[model samples]
Target: MKTRKLTAADAEAYWELRLLALQDHPDAFSTSYEDAIKQEDPIGRVKGNLESPDAETYGIFKEGKIAGNATLRYETPVKLRHRADLVGVYLAPEIRGKGYGKMLITKMFQAARGRDGIEKINLAVADTNPAARHVYEQAGFKPFGVEEKALKMGDTYISEIHMTLVLEDDK
Candidate 1:
């Protein structure tokens, strides 16, 4: 498997994988595949990621197909400029056991570190995803709290684990 940053050319594949993820892991993501597919510009959404200015999207490929994606987006407002939101993380189910998840995350850290005022990275994960939680913990993300039953998936409720990785004070 190879890991690289996301480009506009990779959007269609990204869209397909995202749809697969939502279809398979309905409890894992907030967006529904039905809603996403309704977009008139699927690829444009990927292209527009570039306009985020302080954001980046990375992809992992297995045999030349997009198997996963990770992203970092920064808030530009003066008050929130120093914070970065880590989002859009997904890995193909067939390729889950491989080291790609760790690779994707390490790459996210590298990408997040490149921006100014991005003193930390923040993310939320489902409390049930132990593999993901382990990866985040190894990456230095400390749990802040749990939003109990934060996700209402069909007839059941799920909790979300909120965590953050503080960037080293370059001082």
Candidate 2:
């Protein structure tokens, strides 16, 4: 498997994988497949986001096809400039137990470290997903709180566990 930050040329592959993520794990993502498919110019949006100055979307390729993805977006407000948010994290079901999730997150952390002022990274995962929660905890993220009923999918509600990882202080 190969991993890299996606470029505009990879948007199509990224979009397809994103839809799969939303579809295959409806409860894990905040965006529903229906809402995602209805977005205007999704390919353009994906390209724009991948090329944005404040964020990057990374992809993992299996046999040259996008099989997993993650995104890290830096905060823009002056007061919040030291923080970055992780979202849209997903991996193909076939690849879930192979440590790709850990690798994807590690790459994100490395990217965050390369930024000028980022001192912390934050993410949210469904509390019901113990496997995902365990992955984040093993990566040194500490739970700051839980947002009750954070996501509503039909008649079911899922809580989100908010987590944060503070970078080492060298200042």
Candidate 3:
């Protein structure tokens, strides 16, 4: 498998895979497939965000196809410059448990560590998904808090477990 920071050229592939994530695991993400598909020029939007400052999206490829992805975004405010967020993490169900998830996260941490003033990496995982939570914890993320009923999908509500990984010492 190969991994790299996504670019405008990767917009189509990224969007296709992202849609799969939304459709396959509706409760795991905040965005609904209905909402995402309604956006105009979503490919352009994906490209724009990838090129935006203070944020980056990474993708893992298998046999020339995007199989997984994760995004990291840092705050712009001076006071919050030391923190960054990890979001939009997903792996194709067919590719799970082969170390792709961990590999993607490790890449994110490596990228964060290389950035100046980035001291912490924070992420939110659905509380009901212990497998995903285990992956984050095994990667050294500590639970800071839980947001009750963080996501509402139709009639069901899902809690989110907020986690953080301090990178100061690792720096």
Candidate 4:
């Protein structure tokens, strides 16, 4: 597997990969497949965020196919600029056992460190996703809190775990 900075031209591939994540591994993400597929020009929307100043995407390709992706989205305004939100993380299960998820977040950490003002990386994962939580912990994130029963699906409740990795932790 290989990692690279994302470009606008990669949007179509990104969109499909996103839908795959939302569809195949709904538990690891906050967005529902129904809400995602309803958007018009999904590819364009992905491209827009990927190009923003406070936003960027990185993809991991396996055998010339997109296998995983992670996005870094910052608070869009100056007042909220001290923080950045890490979102849209997904890795295809067919290639899941390998280290792609760890690799993706490592690359994101490096990318974030290069920026002048980003102080922390924050993300929320479902409480049930131990595998992902392990990956994040290995990548230097520490649990801060949880939003109890934050998500509901068909009478099932899923708590959201909030975690953060301080930039200095990389030292």
Candidate 5:
């Protein structure tokens, strides 16, 4: 597998994988597949986001196709500039349980540490997803809190466990 930061040229491939992620695992993301498809100029929006300076989206490619992706988004406010959020984390079902999730998260950590002021990276994982929670824990993320009933789908409610990884300057 190959891992790298995505660019504007990767918009289409990224969007395709993103939609698949939302469709396959509706509970994992905040955005619904129906809502995502309804968005206007989604490709253009993905392209713009890929080109943004405040965020870095990393992709893991297997057999020349995107197998997984995770994004590190830096806070824009001056006081919060030292913090970053790890979001939109998803790996293809076929590739799960094979260690790719941890690898992808490692890349996010590298990207976060490469930035000037980022001292910590935060992320939220659905409490229903033990696999994802285990991966985050193995990557050194500690739980800070939990958001009760963070998402509702149909008649079901899913809570999220908030996690954070503090970066050491020497690392």
Candidate 6:
């Protein structure tokens, strides 16, 4: 498997994988596949995001196809600029249980650390996804709080555990 930061040229593959992730695990994400598919110029938006300086999206490839991805997005507000949010984390089912998820997360950490003034990385994982939570814990993220009814699908509500990892300066 090969891992690297994704660029605007990889937008299509990333978007396709994102849709698959939303469809396969509706409870694992806050955005519904239906809602995501309805967005206008979705690919263009994704391309713009990929090209943005405030965010870095990492991808893991298996046999030259993107099998998983994660993104670290820095806060834009001046006072909040020292923090980043880890979002859009997803790995294909075929690639799970093989450490790729953690690997992808590690890449995010590296990216965050490489950026100046990024002291912490935050993420939210659905309560139903123990596997993802485990991976986050293994990567040194600690639970900060839980948001109840974070996502509603049909008549079911999914809560989310918010986590944070503070980066140690490599001085």
| Comparing 2 and 5 on TM-score, the stronger one | 5
Q: How many clashing residue pairs appear in each of the predictions shown?
A: 0, 0, 0, 0, 0, 0
lDDT accuracy of residue 72 in candidate 6: 90
lDDT of each residue in 1-171, candidate 3, tens digit only: 999999989999999999999998888899999999999999989989989988989999999899999999999998999999999999999889888888999999999988898999999999878889999988889999999999998788999999999985433
Candidate 1 local Cα displacement, residue 28, angstroms? 1.5
RMSD of each: 2.2, 1.8, 1.2, 1.3, 1.3, 1.6
For candidate 2, give the lDDT.
0.91
Query: Distance (Å) between predicted and true CA of 145, model 1?
Result: 1.2
Off by over 4 Å in 5: 169-171
Model 4 C-alpha lDDT per residue in residues 69-129, reported as the tens digit of each score = 8988878677767677888888888878688898999889888877778899899989988
Q: Scored by CA lDDT, what does every candidate get?
A: 0.83, 0.91, 0.92, 0.86, 0.94, 0.93
Predicted candidate 6 versus true structure: per-residue lDDT over 25-128, tens digit per residue: 89998789999999999999999999999899999999999999998999999999999999989999999999999889878888998998999989999999
Please identify which of the two predictions, 1 or 5, would achieve the higher TM-score against the true structure: 5
lDDT of 1 by residue, 1-171 (tens): 888887777777888888988897776777877788888887887788844577888889889998998889888889988888888788988888777788899888888778776788899998778888888887789999999998887788879899998888321
The predicted structure with the larger lDDT, 2 or 5, is 5
Tens-place lDDT digits, model 5, residues 1-171: 999999999999999999999998899899999999999999999999999999999999999999999999999999999999999999998899999998899889889889999999999999999999999999889999999999999999999999988888324
Model 1 segments more than 4 A misplaced: 169-171
> Clash pairs of candidate 4?
none
**Model 6: residue 82 alpha-carbon error in angstroms:** 1.1
Weakest ten-residue segment in model 4 by summed lDDT: 74-83
Model 5 residue 125 lDDT?
Answer: 97
Q: What TM-score, computed on C-alpha atoms, does each candidate reach?
A: 0.91, 0.96, 0.97, 0.94, 0.97, 0.96
What's the distance in Å from true for residue 116, model 2?
A: 0.5
| lDDT of model 2 at position 100 | 92
Candidate 1 structure, TM-score to reference = 0.91
Best of the candidates, lDDT: 5
For model 2, the run of ten residues with the poorest summed lDDT: 162-171
